[model samples]
Target: MWGGSGSGVDYDVMEVYHLPTGAWDQKPTTGTPPPGTWVYSSVAIGKDIYYFGGRGAGDSGYQYQNSLHCLNVDSFKWRELSPSSDYDPMKKGFCGIISVHFDGEHYLVIIGGLGSSSTPKQPNAQYNNSFGDLRCNEIHYYRISSDQWISPVVTGDRPPPINDFTLTPVTNNTAVMFGGETDNGVSNKLYMISFTETSVDILEVPNPGGSVQWPEGRWSHSSVLITTCSGPHLLVVGGDYAYDVWLLDINKRKWKELINLPNNVTRRYWHSLSVWSVTPTTNWIIEFGGLTEYTDTAVIELRYTSDIDWSTSVIPLDQYQDQLRRWILSDWENLGLSKEVQLLRGHLQDRKREFFEEQLQREIKEKEQIQQDRDKEQQQLLQEKATLSQQLDDATTLLEQAEKDKSSLELEYNEKLNAKVAEILEEKTQVEEKKQIITEDYEKLKLKVAHMEEQYLKEKHIIIDDNQNLKSDISEKDKVIAKLTSQVEEQSQNEKQIITDLKEKDLHIAKLVKERQERVLKQPIKETSSIGLQFNYLEEQLQTKNSKQDTPFSRFLILIYLLFISFVLSTNYNSKQFIGKI
Candidate 1:
């Protein structure tokens, strides 16, 4: 079971169930930031939990927030830190927070955050124009002694402009940041940034290429610097859009990819990772949910072997005490306090009996519950087995019956097929016998037809030759008759020609008699005028008649008609519409 502080979206403090037998009753400090807020840095020093440089609240579309808050583990109280008197303002967003304890003093270092700078753009800019630019690479130390934040000058070159990078305290003075998205939006570089009591140094760690790179270039990843059997190693677990487990050997400067997490473990980012060393051999790292691009409240656990690497061993409390008692008694004897050591040993024995009795009763109750659950599961398995056996028996019987039915059907089908085959064979034999007899009869009929055809052809040839001789004789007689008719027609034509010559001579004689009669009549009429006068009068009358009928206008009329004819010819040539010419 899990518990959290705050109501609505601002669920900040997360409590996990750690006790084995009792219900979880722990609560986190109230008024912490909500669960979905991006907690960029966190470090636990002693019993204090300090978180800084997270962004939430306001209307800046993810306000670049810079506030430091601390949780007292015993009191569960929330404390917010303000800007130091010397510093300009409480730098938010871009700062890196890491906890370090050196020389018996704990300090929370805030380095490189977005702070007050020149306004980025003009007032009338179309884009969002609030928050100033990133500040210099000054590291501010929160000294727990003075309860004040101090801006310390960082030595060497500063890290490139970046936000949301993970910082893990490898030693009391050194911290490693790996694979965080820069302001330019590129990830995948390991940076070893260390701070001594005097100065800070940043070194770029070259990547050793392999199937996968170390510090797997991601933003909002959770990492914890832990001491294991192999010495101080940084265990980098989940991150934004990553599911691989990576372990960085800080001492050896090497890296190893761990096995994949179980299905129940979430591969997420921007979550809280905390390491609590319960014993010298066992250290448990608890991860509470943060923004997984959206709000997430998934909690995950990872167990690491402690530096001492103590294996499981049981030591009876009585035996442990007896050894301590003997050692203390020896020291007392040298110090002359033997009587007091014996009294202390007697008191421990009396309390041990009562404690053992209580432990025995609790163990008995737990064993009984375990036995009951085992019995119930065994009964269920038996019932399932019985039911499955019965079903299998029924299936077997049905399958046997189906097989018998199939066999009977197959025999009947075969018998029917055989009877059909026998009937077809008998019909085939009768048809073959009939076909042989018909073939012999066809051959005899063919010979008889051939003999009749030969006899008919010989008679047809004799008749054709006799017809040819008769046609030749008839044609010769017709030609002789045609010659005799032509000779008779020629004699008739000669007689007719003689008759036509006599008729022509008679016509000539008649014409001569008519001409003589005309001449006699003309001689009688000429008595009234002289012959010359009659000739002149006739010539004048002819000339006057020609002039009156044909004037000069006739020539003009002829010319106009000729011109109209020419115009008609040209118009006919130009008039292409009738022919549809182009």
Candidate 2:
């Protein structure tokens, strides 16, 4: 019995049929029970049915229930087990729990599941960020006798935290875990987890590519282990967005997807799948419950035979159909195996034998075909090997010739490189010497200009003072008019001599400036060089002064200064450009 919609208020009751009395009884627990929830893990061990974690009724955090309860099938009584103090029930739910009997003791094994947190049931909106956390990967074992939860030491390539996976026990010590949802996305990887007395080891099964097309990635699928005459294999059923069935061959470690099944079988998730029969004659995988486009209450069956083949048969009855519904409500004895059905079974057995014979013959033919193909491939390989050997010898001869050519070219390149380096070094030495000479001349010119500026300022001050004295001595100036005239003439002669000397000095400066300009013009401007930067600064200064107020004398001085600077700049620019050509 389980709870469904309407806030989980409606609990669906199960009908149990008594085999001997041929009577049906509606069974529902009367005592206090676990909360109504979804996605819970349950397993039946002997007469007790155990239930674990799932989504409970409420909102957000209150929605995940962590209760563990067991119902007695014989007495219809519910009992809750109290784990040790170290074990917390709230965090114990929502894991893939299974009961396995080993060494005469039953132990409940729990695999990965959703942790104690709240998340959106369906994260449809793009902006919804409600993914919680995944539970631990360590396998948790609960001892039924001791009532203790023990986490065994697990080693090997531990799988990432995942949930909604199907873990079916293949044997007492081995179990196979199929696809599950992870933080990254849905996974289709399969692993074989082996349990021992002290430790657990998990090994990933490789899906080597071959003729068989593997199943696509999915979660919330159903898988159950079944033993066949060939070997043990897992029968996987429908999952989210899937209606196809696949079989995982344990011995071969490969997948073979089932096709051509009845059309009524559709994709399902949160469905129950189990091994319905383990008889040698016919084995069956039964699927029930879960949603497919909407709520589904259909029971489906898959029949397997010793010939290692699968077929689906419709039971012709469902949970809702009243007519022929007694087929589901009663045991096999109540609706005894009719003679017609028995005859059909016998016919199936005959067909099964015929299938095995045909299959055997097919295998022999396939083997012979494979052998012939292999021999043909071997002959082709030998011929190719001989052809490759001849080609390799030719390549070796060509390689030697290429090596000789490379050595000659390398020698020629080295010689050219050495000559270029020597030429560059000689040029560098000449440039350094020229730089020293230019720097010395520049220093001399700078000192001379400073001296001239100082002398000009002193002479201007003295002239102004002399004019003021003449104005104050006007009366004396008239009485000594004759003496003043002679003094003026002498002063005029001295002024003329000074002017002549100044002109000669200016001419000397102009000559030196012209020579430097000629040298500068021989080279191109080196934009990043120190001399280039100085030239730019001087040009700016000349421009600024020319733009400001100026007298006739100052203007003439500016003109000469600008001419000298411009000539020098032109020379440097030409020199640098010429050097680049070299």
- The residue ranges of model 2 lying beyond 4 angstroms of the native Cα positions read 4-9, 12-25, 58-61, 83-94, 117-130, 262-264, 294-297, 306-308, 318-582
Residues 188-289, model 2: lDDT tens digits: 888988887556788997766577567777788888877755678788887775677888888788777778665445577767765644233234444556
C-alpha-based local distance difference test score of model 2: 0.66
Where does model 1 exceed 4 Å of error? 1-40, 56-62, 83-90, 102-104, 113-138, 210-215, 263-266, 278-282, 291-582
Highest lDDT: give the candidate number: 2
How does model 1 fare in lDDT? Answer: 0.58
**How high a TM-score does candidate 2 get?**
0.50
Model 1, 148: alpha-carbon shift in Å? 4.1
For the record, the alpha-carbon RMSD of candidate 2 to the native fold, in angstroms, is: 36.6
* Alpha-carbon TM-score of each model against the true structure: 0.44, 0.50
